[model samples]
Target: MSEFDQHFPLFSFPPSKVPRLLNPLVLAYIGDAIYDTYIRTYLVSLPHHKPNHLHHEATKYVSAKAQAHFLKLWLPHLSEEEQDMVRRGRNAKSATIPKNANVLDYRHSTAFECLIGYLYYKQQHKRLSQLLKMIIDYKENEH
Candidate 1:
C-alpha cells in the first residue's frame, strides 16, 4: 500500500545467491529518497509544527553529521555485502557537497542515503524500516 510497495521488487530470490546484492548504487539512490521521506514524515507528524519549523527540525536530523552517526550505528549490523554497499556509496564521486556541510560529511551522508535507497528499491521494506526506526529512535531519545 506504500509507494515503496510500487517501487521495490517483490520477489523471492533463489537460495543459492542471496548473500547481499550486485548493485550497490541502486540501494544508495533509493535509500536517499527513503531516508528523506522518513525525515519529512517525522517532522510533519509533530503537532502544530509550522513548515519552517518542520524544515528546520528535519534538516537537523538529515544532515551529514546525523547520517554519519547512523552509519556508525549501522556498521556493526551490516553484512560484508552491506558494508561494501556503504563503502561504494561513501566513496562515490560527486559533483557537489551539501550547502553548508563539509566534503567528508557529505560523502558519508550520501552513502547512508544510498544504503536506504538500495534497501527500499530491493523491496526489503522491513529491513528499510528497521534502519530508519533506529535513526528516529536515536534522535527521539537524544533529547
Candidate 2:
C-alpha cells in the first residue's frame, strides 16, 4: 500500500490497480459515497449547528442537482485527460434514476462522481482538493 492508503484507507485493494480496470459506473458508485462523506465532514466541522439544519446544509452540496452544477462550472478547467474521464462517466449506462433529479442532471452528477472517484483512485488528493475548493469558494462568494 502507498502512504495514502495507510492514511486515508479508501479501499481494501490498491488504488492504482483498480482505477484503470473498473467501469465508470462502478467508480461513480464509490465516488458518490466519497463525495457525500467529504460534504458531511466539512459541514460537521463548521460552527455548531442543529442536526436538522446540518442535514439541510449538507443536501445543498451533496444533491445531484448541486453536483451537476459544480461539474458544469468545473468542466472547462479540467485537463484533457480529466475531460475524457468525465465523458466516459457521462456516457456510462445506468439502470436506475433518482426520483428527484432529471436525466441530464443525473448523468452530469454521475460524471462528477466519476471524476471524484478517478481522483481518489489515482491518489490525486491535491488536485481533488483544489477542484472541490474552487467550487465551494465560488458558491460562497456568489452569495
Task: Report the C-alpha lDDT of model 2 over 1-143, residue by residue, as the tens digit.
Answer: 54333334556665545685779998898789878877777677689689999999888888889999999999889999789889989999999999999999999999999999988888787787778778668877988
TM per candidate: 0.78, 0.88
As a whole number from 0 to 100, the lDDT of residue 142 in candidate 2 is 85
Q: Which lDDT tens digits does candidate 1 get at residues 1-143?
A: 54434334444542233325534455555567667777776677679588788888887778788888789889988878667778988888877676788888888887888777666555568777677777778888987
Pull out the clashing pairs in model 2: none
For this target, which candidate reaches the highest lDDT against the unseen true structure? 2
Q: What lDDT would each prediction earn against the true structure?
A: 0.71, 0.83
For model 1, the superposed segments whose C-alpha errors exceed 4 Å read: 1-27
By TM-score, the best candidate is 2
Q: Pick out the ten consecutive residues of candidate 2 with the lowest summed lDDT.
A: 1-10
